[model samples]
Target: MGLDDDIAILATAPVFELFERDALRLLSFAGERRHLDEGELLFSRGEPSDGGYVVMAGTLALIPRRPGEEPVKVSRSGLIGRNALFRQVERPADARATEPSEVMRVTPSVMSRVLREFPDVAAAIHGGMAEELLDLVRGLSGVQERLTRLSPRKR
Candidate 1:
């Protein structure tokens, strides 16, 4: 795909929705494009993560560590390894290509450079993370409320 196509894909992705077109263009230019054959392993569990992958085509299977577990199939235009963008974490599951696939690899180093260069992008990312945290807290509060309701009343 061309630069415009890449930008379009990035713009539509939920993770990049807060980013401007210019930021998306910068990401497209800096990111590496990788192609995998069917049944190829994209990444394995416990591996140190450098970045995330934006699927451009085909499907990837996220396989759990436990044997006999059903793998989660992710299709086109999905983002994987999102935490890698902000932290140095290990892969939680094995990712394999279920079919011939194309992905754009976005490294944390590259993102760090971009964030340094564009303070606005960094601010936006921070805001997004804050919102996510707030949502998680709200969800937990609801769960706590449900647990309280389910518990027996004290004398």
Candidate 2:
């Protein structure tokens, strides 16, 4: 996609709107466009991760499978890859193209550049991080509550 297309995509994404035009330009420098077929694995569990993705078209799926547990289909995205950005080390889930898809790969180097040059963009990403962390905490708390209910209680 051209710069105008990139701008349009950025305009729709909540976090991208925070980046300055100049910072967005810096992003274009290192970004790469990719296309994937239906059922293609964008990245598998435990693979070395480099960065995140922004979807230009079609759908992508997040499938998580922990050992000895059933796989879970997380959700599908039409505009961005959220899990790829905040990965701690390797991916805990698998991402795949649910249909013919087009996405832009934003490398760590470019992400670092954006954080350094555009405080607003960094702040937006941090906001996203906070929300995600909250969701994680809520999910964990629910799990703990369930476990407590299941365990034998003291008199």
Candidate 3:
């Protein structure tokens, strides 16, 4: 695919949508592309993840190590290992291509450059993350309030 195509695909991902065309162009230019055959392992659980993959084509499955954890299906334009784009971490699950797939790997170093070059994108990400955390806290507080009400009074 062309650079424009890569940028279009990247733009579909939530975080990348905050980026400008020039930022996307930089990412497409620097990001590494990989092809996966059907049932190929993209990454294994416990492996050190240094980057994220944007699914350019086909479907991939994220199989969790924990028995009860659900597997997630990622299709075109889906971004996996999103957190790893910013920081290196151990993979919590195995990612395998369910079908022939193409992915663009965006390393933390590349991501850093994008953020440094695009302050608006970085600030938007920071604000979005803070909002997510606050929402989680608020939800937990509501759960706590409900639990307190349900509990029997001290005898």
Candidate 4:
């Protein structure tokens, strides 16, 4: 795909929607394209995460190492590993291509450069992270409330 096409795809994602057209263009330019055959491993759990992948075509299965958990399937135009944009942590799960797949790999260095150059992009990313944290907190509060109700209290 051309630069404009990549930018258009990036813009479709909520996280990238905050960025300007020029920023998206820069991201598309910096990103590396990857192709995977069916059943190929994209990344394994415990591997150091240096970047995130944007699934441009086909499906990727996120397989949990823990027993009893079902693998989560992500399809075209989906964004994975958003945390990799800032965090230097090990991958939490295995990602495999469920079919012939195409992805755009955005490295942390590229993201850092963009963030450094564009204050608006950085602010938008921070705001998005804050919103996500708030949602997580709200979910945890609900779970705590339910647990409290289920448990008997002593006078």
Top candidate on lDDT is 3
Better of 2 and 4 by TM-score: 4
| 1-155: candidate 2 lDDT, tens digit per residue | 68877766765654566677877777666678889999998888777776777777777776657566654432222434455454435776787887788777777667777788888788887897799899999999999999999999899
lDDT of 3 at 16: 93
Lowest-scoring 10 consecutive residues by lDDT in candidate 4? 8-17
- lDDT by residue for model 1 (61-151), tens: 9999899999988777688888887677999999999999998888989888778877887899899989999999999999999999999
Candidate 4: tens digits of C-alpha lDDT, residues 16-63: 778889898888889889999999999999999979888888999999
TM-score, cand. 2 vs. native: 0.68
Q: Pick by TM-score: which candidate is best?
A: 3
Question: Order of candidates by TM-score, top first?
Answer: 3, 4, 1, 2
**TM-score for every candidate vs. truth?**
0.90, 0.68, 0.94, 0.91
Question: What local distance difference test score does each model get?
Answer: 0.88, 0.71, 0.93, 0.88
By lDDT, is 3 or 4 better?
3
RMSD in order of candidates: 1.7, 4.0, 1.3, 1.6
TM-score of 4: 0.91
lDDT (C-alpha) at residue 56 in model 3: 95
Per residue, candidate 3 scores C-alpha lDDT tens digits across 1-155 of 88888889999887898889999999999999999999999999999997999999999999977798778999999999989999999998999999999998999999999999999989989999899999999999999999999999999
